[model samples]
Target: MENAVLLNAIIENAIDGIITIDDRGLVESINPAACSLFGYTPGEVIGKNISFLMPPPDRTHHDEYIQRYQHTGVPHIIGIGREVKGLRKDGSVFPFMLGVSEVTLSGRKIYAGFIHDLSQQKRAEEQLKDYATHLEEIVDERTFSLQESVEALQNAKEEVSLSLEKEKELSQLKSRFVSMASHEFRTPLSAIQLSASLIDKYAQPFKSEHIAKHVGKIKNAVGNLTTILNDFLSLEKLEAGRVEPSFAPFDLVKLSEEITEEMQMVAKQNQHIIYQHTGKESVVTLDQNLLKNCIFNLIANAIKYSGENTFIEFNTEITGNAITIVVKDNGIGIPEKDQKHLFEPFFRAHNTGSIPGTGLGLNIVARYTHLMNGSVDFKSIVNQGTSFTILFKRHE
Candidate 1:
């Protein structure tokens, strides 16, 4: 008697609604929570058919389902919990999680349903989805703004100068183009990257692998576009005579090691950038920014052109009166015919295939080196390997 009273007390005090139905689908018992949930008292619901508490087709077919379960013994909702619609006495519908179990009591089979309300959770999820949509809208707006800016630049490029000298006009135009592109393109690209990261983070809990993959693709494409824009900006600055090498004294070993570590994160599977500095002297007096750009461009090219599991050899040797930086790769090297025009702006190698690049990387590197009193040289054999060396004469 104590155990029966205890079980009844526990069921009545449970937060989740509980209801029991006879095999014929009549409500045999309803706990206080269940009564409160459906806006019905136990006296009104206990002897009534449970279909009155279900919405639409469920209410119409509830008896059929009970009969089918009794005859066939094939369970659908019997042992499984799933989201379902519930109807209240006020003719309103709501969402809930219903877990139904079968119990045999005194040689009679009855079904017990455990219900947990899901209206609040559903509302929260909808709000989260709305926030994500808002983020996407912001990203789209920024992307459209960047497009308009690019169009404006193109229009400016087509206009003829009125009074200024041709060289000066062209220089000013290039400088404006570089400045506009840098600001316009970078802002949207950064938004895209950030939005993609947030979307990936939000989708993680749902185990949305495909969403994560597409987000990764968006980030990678944004990175590539940013890289191409940087190349164009660098080329424009060089053409407009805006870039000048600022020479400084820095540790070459530390710079090279940092670059190697940073670039390794983006390398292909098993691809390694092996960096080494030779000679006792690790200090060099040169344009640190330009030199770093030159090295980064070469290693990036090596990684792009090389296959997985390949090694990119990056070595810096400080010999007497001279410093040499070499990047060697055993990838698809440039064809002999295309070698001469490799450093030309927008000129991709004939053998480059579908690899994405602006073809301005080498040009920028060459110009940067020339500004710093350095020389760029490369030797390539198609399908075998390529090696690029940047030689700088140490200034006293």
Candidate 2:
């Protein structure tokens, strides 16, 4: 009696739908879960054919299948489980898993069925598939955009290469033109300088200070033109990449002394250039011609910018692995605004009012220093003075 009561309680409270049918496929019992699944009451389903709860073709063949199983001892859904369709009282169709088992009670055969609803599980699976499809679409769009950006960058690189090539060709043409023009102008300039010197020599006999004065002006003008032409020629060679440094062992002290003597001859009245040397080891390996040109440019600038009777200091120092040369002058120094561009080609300081200059000197110096693996730097305060320093690694 206790076992019967427990079994009845489990079946009545079971979560899955449960049903019992006779051998003729007539419903004998139905649980509350089964009633809820089929939208029917126990009074409506009990004593009716179980086929009424199954949809369509299954409803028609259900009774025949049960008779075949009873006579032939063959089992279709009996003792087996499969997914099948069910019908509700409202004519709605749904899917479920059904398992059937056969039992004998009081000389009569009965079949029990268990139904588990599959609607919620099927819906969740479908939603996962849709989300996967959406992710694939987003990945494809981002890949296409990345490909387009790479192609655009490639196009920009090609354009820059073409522009650089054109710029190189233009620079070559300019260099050639300047070279030709400098050569052409020098001949006439030389003739004018010679004639002016002769006129001054001849007028000295007449003792006429007026003719001497005018001749001096002519000589100075011719000299300035010659200097400008030389600057242009030097710049042309440098831009054309023709100026190569030829390194050799040379005496730094001797070179500095010779340069000082040569430049001192051209200094303004009462202006002096003081030369000094540090460290007894004066020999260094460098391109002598290039070094001379760099030093010459700096001292010339000092002489030109400084007031008459001022002193220009030229110093050279030799230490372990380093060689330094400094040229400082008390001259009309560069302004703060113009100092940043001092080494750029054709850049003149704003403080240079009425002072004649081609503005290529410091630029040439900087390039020459770089060719020899050296560096050049300067400091200047307006109306006070300017100092330029060049340093190189001493090659032993």
- The candidate scoring highest on TM-score is 1
Q: Clashing pairs in model 2?
A: none
- lDDT of candidate 1 vs native? 0.84
Worst 10 residues of 2 by lDDT: 149-158
In model 2, the number of clashes is: 0
**What lDDT tens digits, residue by residue, belong to model 2 across residues 1-396?**
999999999999999999998877789999999999999999999999988998999998987897887788775666555889999999999888988888889997788999998877677656654644553454344335433433443343344434545767656655664665566656766776787677667656555555565566656666666666677678778887899999898999999999999999999999999999999799899999999999999999999999898999999999998999999998989899898899976678888877877778999999999999999999898889999999998655
- Residue-pair clashes per candidate: 0, 0
> Candidate 1: misplaced stretches above 4 Å?
1-10, 22-26, 36-40, 48-95, 100-111, 122-169, 182-218, 239-244, 277-281, 307-310, 319-322, 351-354, 393-396
Q: Model 2's lDDT to the true fold?
A: 0.82
lDDT of 1 at 219: 72
**Residue 285 of candidate 1: its Cα lDDT?**
86
- Highest lDDT among the candidates is held by which one? 1
Q: How far is candidate 2 from the true structure (C-alpha RMSD, Å)?
A: 33.0
Poorest lDDT segment (10 consecutive residues) of candidate 1: 154-163
